[model samples]
Target: MHAITKTKPVPFLDLSAQYKSLEAEWLAAIRETGARGSFILGPNTQALEKEFAEYVGVKHAIAVANGTDSLFLSLRALGVGKGDEVVTTPFTFFASAETIDMAGATPVFADILPGSLCLDPASVRARITAKTKAIVTVHIFGYPTEMGEIMEIAKKHKLAVVEDCAQSFGALHNGKVVGSIGDTGSFSFYPTKVLGCYGDGGMVTTHSDAVDERIRRLRNHGAVKPFVHTEIGMNSRLDEVQAAVLRIKLRHIKDDIAGRQKVAQEYTQRLAGSPVKTPSLPKNGTHVFNLYTIRVPKRDAVRQALTDAQIGTSQCYPQGLHLQEVYKHLGYKPGSLPACEHATTETLSLPIYPGMPLDHIERVCEVLLEAVRG
Candidate 1:
């Protein structure tokens, strides 16, 4: 009789472990804010904006209610509205394109690079037309896009550039931080993001003082002064509680990113020579490893095997934006963007986070290998 061996289940993202690690600091900050009676856009939020701006090497940072609003407000502040077209990659979260539509602009789809899954600069150039007013570039899975080329393209066309930093809190491109390179950058603090708050929170970074002042007013119902509305705007202020929580987490972000990098290296080393194509890091950029995604055959089957073994996994996006029913009216056929469609079919995100155990990585690789071989 062989002895039974038990395997510990690995979660895709262990938010509880993360919370436990900083419970004391987070609790203290929350308690202090509650005692101060400053709930909405107060000292904590203001301080967070200042610290975040410094971190991103930007002149200003505006804290908003969520990531979507960050993008919407950035577009609106740039005067992108009806009859305008925003160019962006189709292989990303819907918000990247949805916000363009929310701003009353049409989203023009561009393909992505097969390796990095970031927008292809050539594809972006091909999409530009007379109506194109902006480009919303997303750092998918924390991999920075080729900003040098994209920036040149934007400059040639005189288009506004909005960097969607939702999945890339600390990623860098060509020795420059992502948020600082573009005209405006939007960051999300959803619980699963690289640097997240307890609840929904977001920030916008920019170097232009004019854009900064406009976004500040746009976030607060276009109020240049208290109760004085200049233009129609929605309410999207970051709460002091979430701001305090983010401030504490920001203190440990570097260490957290290091831990995630370690885990990613382990996965790459272990999965070497396997059919699975591991993430490729750019020599001139830094990847924060928000989601350690890989390309593999039989992706769905492998994902199912991992799930059956009680090891969690995810598909960051099962469908590209052009293929979504909402965009069917855009008249894009199935193969309009081959790279983006291929990515949707092949990519799978394995369990990964800061401080993940080596044993868990080994188990996931073992299960994935067996499934792939079979």
Candidate 2:
């Protein structure tokens, strides 16, 4: 075994470093957003909606309170409800499946592709049945899902398709932006995401004007007027302040994605042929490197070693949603959906954000090697 190693203090995420680069501009924008006093459904929100819609190459973008709400509204807009089933990958953030349940539908688990770690279309096809009304395919870890195959299956089954692009804004599949490829594309601006705002915010992208109109109403208490309610809807609107912050961040998103790509490349070059299964990029998809994840044996020990070495690491979905007690009623066992289940035990995400330096990447690789040597 290699000798245990040490590293200088490393943070899992350095949001402050990114903020410092844009501090002056962001502060000014925040003050401006506040002064307008048009806190909700204001000019900033409308502007962001237009810009983001264009960025994703879609006709409409509906701003919502958060990512989960974006997915919920998408399901509602697609007419997904009780006695319906939405086919989804088990190897993703729970919100993908949870939104289906929130929309009064069941979430059917599907396996993921071995290479891209996105939903496998064959698995999706196998799971489809009469109850299946839609497919919610997640772009896991910023890698675009196989949209072509999934879309064909959805078309064959007459099902709606929702692209869970929360981790994959700006990513592309077959030259088309991920959000534009589905009936609705959902994005999150949580503080940690690549294109994050100052606080919680999310948006849904769609080409259908009809779906856009429904989402617009659903986000604001299902009302066309101030007091009249057309249908029961939840409160989920992106306020002006958050929208303004998003607008500022959006301008630099391409540059941010480039920087993250650099870090990911460095990690891959440094860790090549090591005892870890490095993240893979598909030939047909563009990767945004939201979180550079790897699968390794003895994940816990490596995590502890990295912690001891002052290098930060974390587990992404350490337990797959199906294995959780919350959904034990689904009757999934250890062998069910083996790909996602195996990933839950072996995956670990390393720090690879825009602001990390090459030295940090090198030290991280060195420390990881030492930890796994044991």
Residue 266 lDDT (model 1): 92
- Candidate 2 lDDT over residue span 170-256, tens digit each: 998999988999999999999889789888999999999999999999898899779988999889999998888788889999999
On lDDT, the leading prediction is 1
How many residue pairs clash in each candidate at the backbone level?
0, 0
Q: Estimate each model's TM-score.
A: 0.98, 0.97
What are the runs in model 2 whose C-alpha is more than 4 Å off?
1-7
Which segments of candidate 1 are over 4 A away from where they belong? 1-7
Residue-level lDDT of model 1, residues 196-267, one tens digit each, is 987899999999999999999999988989999999888999999999989989999999999899999999
Tell me the lDDT of model 2 at 107.
Answer: 91
Residue 283 error, candidate 2, Å = 0.2
